[model samples]
Target: MKPQRRLRLGMVGGGEGAFIGAVHRLAARMDDRYELVAGAFSSSLENCQRTGAALWLDPARCYASYQKMAAQEADGIDVVAIVTPNFLHAPVATAFLQAGIHVICDKPLCLNAQQASQLAAVVKQSQCQFILTHNYSAYPLIREARQRVLSGELGEIRFVEVEYLQDWMSELVEQTDNKQASWRGEPAKAGAGCIGDVGTHAWQLASFVSGMLPQSLSAELATVVAGRALDDDVRVTLRYANGARGRLWASQVASGHENSLRLRIYGSEASLEFQQENPNQLWIRPRNAPAYCLTRGSGVLSDEVRTMGRVPAGHPEGYLEGFGQIYREAADQIWAAIDGQPFSGSLLPGIDDGVAGMKFIDAVRHSSMADGKWVDFSAA
Candidate 1:
């Protein structure tokens, strides 16, 4: 194989004090397949300049707006990672895709399904890869679980239960000086609050692991925080195509919890359980048999999982490692497309995953407003 060229990456949003922007940079650098060449670090010009200088980025490559950055970096940047707030995702992504750059975007693709559809059209027209960072799907054990279900070891999955809960905003943290909680609690910046933020992760993980799309859903949303415009908690019940039933709950106001993402899948012959806090191991129980614990680097793991697993069985790899896998796989696809070569392996989450997530969010929002009635997600 010829030596792969490093992709020149431009970032939109993710300035000082932003959570996910730095995470994207770290993930991209992990595989050494991409370089951060340019960025519009923040919405404000001064912040963008300060952030650029802090990162040792060239002044010429940093811009005040994504529109200017996209036009200027079109010939240089191979990919653009959009890490801005939810409302900016569609516009920034549209700008880059229109300029012929592949996009690796954060989840909850856009503010609405219509915006997601517009972005999808651009992606199709450009024929460029659009990777959605559903980072949970990159976990080695999660990959193993997916393969097990596909291989019929689980024997027809029938139910899925996914929950992503956090206690950060439980008690009106947004009223204080917490930067993360402030904008996230605002309806304009964060989109649909908990449903658009963490709920999308739970929804994506359930579908990614189960290989099923939600057909319809019933949902309820709550604003536990006083004076908050958007929901801080969400509960959704999902109906899948193959008669599978699933439930998802995401809350920033769940007391005593912090980034606790859990998934349980039950089938006719077996069941599997995986948790984000304990990412290295997966619990598997076959019908009428003893329960088994599968670790990331163990002999019981699949080739795909093993290849992605970086450490030994006793050692641990968590968020950073899983995030790195997503970036590496994305880089593989981007580089393949750039070099006019075929991609090597599957990367589960893509533009379609983004569309599905946006549809899920919109459907749940509609369902909540409709007195928790079932809403057809297909219409999204």
Candidate 2:
């Protein structure tokens, strides 16, 4: 296949001081797969201008709202990266998808399942590529874990445990003009707060590695912080249709923990573990055997996992590189779409994944409200 021109990418959010916005930008540019051409960086025009100027975007292309950006760039931009708050995700993604532009949006899909369903419809009707930025799924070791699990290296998966913990919201940071925390803590703006934020990532990571979806769930969602509206902590049990069980625990008030996302999957024959903080190494333990560490960029890595690593073994490739992998995969799909060719083997999360995430979130909330009843996950 002939190499296509670099993808023309636009942004709907990620203005100044928004952590994930900068992350999306860096990820998009990391592999040279995309060029940021346009953006409505923030709701405030002044902030948008500042962000546009900082990103070296043409002033005329940075609009005041996502609607204008979508309408005006419909013919020019090939992809729109939606990095706004959770509530804006559905609307912004819908507009871009309707405009026939592919989308690379931040995760948790939308504010709720209804919005997720609506956005899923838009994506289906438009037939546009929609890539949800579940960056953790892009890690090379995580890909290795998925491949190993699929190849039966770990035998029958019996138990899975995943946790994502952070201490940023342990205190009432939302009350101190912390823009990220402010919107994130608000139910209207962030949907389910910690659950929607990092919890969704945990959910996606678990499903991605184990290749199993929860059939039923019992959840306890709590607001650890006194003044917080939405959940700051969550603990959920997952029952898989295949009789495999799992547990997920996510918290923003886990004091002293910062970005401590970890996954442990145990099978009848073996087990595998991976941690986000030490992303370069994956642990594998066979039945009655000592644990062994597998490092990235090693010759032992499978071809698929090897391709995801940019540097050699000792040099670390963490969050940004993992994020870039997702962008590269999305770029491949986008080019395939443009060239009218068959697209295959893409691991990037799409609209269906987004909807499922919303449903998982809804199930958690409902189960919590119902006193931790075993809620049917399919019904979510």
What are the RMSDs of all candidates, in order? 1.4, 1.0
Candidate 1: which stretches are off by over 4 Å?
A: 2-4
Q: Each prediction's TM-score against the native?
A: 0.96, 0.98
Tens-place lDDT digits, model 2, residues 183-291 = 8877888888889999999999999999999899999999887877888999999999878999999999999999999999999889999999999999999998888
Give all candidates' CA lDDT scores: 0.87, 0.91
How well is each residue in 66-185 modelled by candidate 1, as lDDT tens digits?
Answer: 999888888989999999878888888888999999999988898888888888999999898899888889999989988888888989889999999998887877778888787776
lDDT of model number 1: 0.87
